[model samples]
Target: MTPYENVTFKERLHEEAAKLKEMSFRDKFWYIWEYYKFPIIGVVIAVFLVGSIGSAMYNNRFDTALSCAVLNSRYDSEALTVDQYFDEGFRAFIGLDENTKIDVDYSMSPSFDESAMNEYSYAELAKLTAMISSKGLDVMIGRPDVIDHYGEMDGFLNLEEALPADLYEQVKDYLYPVTNAETGQESFCGIRIGDTSFGEKTGLILEDPVLTIMSNSPHTDTAIQLIRYIFEQ
Candidate 1:
């Protein structure tokens, strides 16, 4: 029996339209906000979320061809140079497309000496552990101590098994043996690269640099190719 009881949807629409036409812009905005504030806010938030998700997906679209980590590196200035050199050179050597990515991480600098260890070192160690556990890292280049630290955890692939016979034989004299902590078995886990022309070519000042491939690497072929490419260069 109320005045609204007789009103149809079309009549309500017309009444609102007429009221909006007579109102000022500010009044109209307030009126609409009063009526549709929740819906407008919800739509805006939904759009923002969608845009954020789309951007993230697009940015991460490329597949990683190789993921190499340089731990406890002495030369901080060579990070960009190393990253660019390997990324471009390796891509060209392998004929990889632009859509594929090669990641070279040089940020980690974990200290082996307990007295020298700090929060940053601990964080770097955690990051390295996470990367290895997730199979996100393919290769590691570091000092002998750094290489041995991870090798003790059985982190690296035995070069005898991981590499082709010819390649293993080629670098047999440079092999760095590490004893597995769990099994107490000794194996060749890394190859010494510091004595090579790697430092001069890459502008990295390495002292006893060793290269090791991860045991759980998903890109073993690519990693092997990388080692071959390094030696070739």
Candidate 2:
């Protein structure tokens, strides 16, 4: 009922605002945080959830550390036709121990095309390019024409350079010449797994396929091991 009673509503509002402005910086920060804490927490949780989903999708799209795809458009079987017995052998060779068994993603598809993409549609070509760049393709088993096409683009690893000394010796004689698509020059870029062997002394029987490693393959050791097992069998 004294001087405070004389203060009008406008004056009281200004007084409170001035008091707030005069508050310490730390106090103001706490005031703001307390007022908006719920919203801030919600925003943070939303960001975290989005990031988690995005990371999972990215990994699922490109993760193929143990996959080996054989591209042969001539054969259209969706399921793997390779003998399971060899799969068992390769798994045993690559596994860490007796109890720690490994699963191999052996796949075959006839949809692949050369760098020119003469046979693949736009979507198929894009998927193929992505697979190659991501190192998802470990080994490629195809006929001579297909091998030659990829070899020209430097897509396949040079067998002479990639195989171990012992394994190289076993297959060196069977690596047939292929004309590079880019250079128009011939190179020993593929091993003829079909109808040939290392002079028959090794008792290795050849099948009707040419095997090559992708240049960007992450599992070169496994690829070599698989090749070795195939020829040995």
Candidate 3:
């Protein structure tokens, strides 16, 4: 029986508009907020989600030509310099277009020793595990202990199989043999780079640095090329 009960939607809208027009700007704002706050918030959230998804999709459109990680690095300055050098040099070495991306991550410093392990080390290990599982990591460069830890997990490709026969023969003396914990089979999983001119050329110091290729690398050819490039340099 109320007057508004019989009014059409258009009529009600006009009445509300007229009321808003008569009110001060402050009152109009509060009135609209009181009635439409939920809808306005929903619109804002929807816009943010749409924008995030679009950004992710656009970013993923570029193919990752190669991704390498340096673990347990001691000097941040040297690592950072080498990181930039590799990012620029590798792209040029491979003759990749700008659309293709190459990443050299030196941010991880995982400690495998029980006494040295902490929350941060565990977090880095988890991140490394996730990247390897997703095939996002192509190569790993680290100390002998770090390489051995992952090698025992059967995480690396056998250099004998991964490298060209001639290349393998050239570095055969420097091969790091690792025994798989599960299969008990021994394979040459890493190449000892510390003894090479790697430290001299790159200025990244490590006691016994080794390079290993991930078993599930999507870019094995690029990984091999990277190994060759490192030794060649």
Which of the two candidates, 2 or 3, achieves a greater TM-score against the reference? 3
Clashes of 1: 0
Give the per-residue lDDT digits (tens) of candidate 1, residues 190-221: 99887676666566777788999999999999
In angstroms, how far off is 15's CA in candidate 3?
53
Q: lDDT of model 2 at residue 51?
A: 53
**Which ranges in model 2 have alpha carbons more than 4 Å from their true place?**
1-65, 73-86, 96-122, 183-185, 196-207
Write model 3 residue lDDT over 44-122, tens digit each, in one string.
Answer: 5555455545743564688888888877666645444675456677678878787787877767888877897654555
lDDT of each: 0.80, 0.60, 0.80
What TM-score should be assigned to candidate 1? 0.71
Best TM-score among the predictions, by candidate number: 1
Winner of 2 and 3 under lDDT: 3
In model 3, residue pairs whose N, Cα or C atoms come closer than 3 Å (at least 3 residues apart or on different chains), thus clashing, are none
Question: In lDDT terms, how accurate is model 3?
Answer: 0.80
Ranking by TM-score: 1, 3, 2
Model 3: runs farther than 4 Å from truth? 1-59, 76-80
Worst 10 residues of 2 by lDDT: 198-207
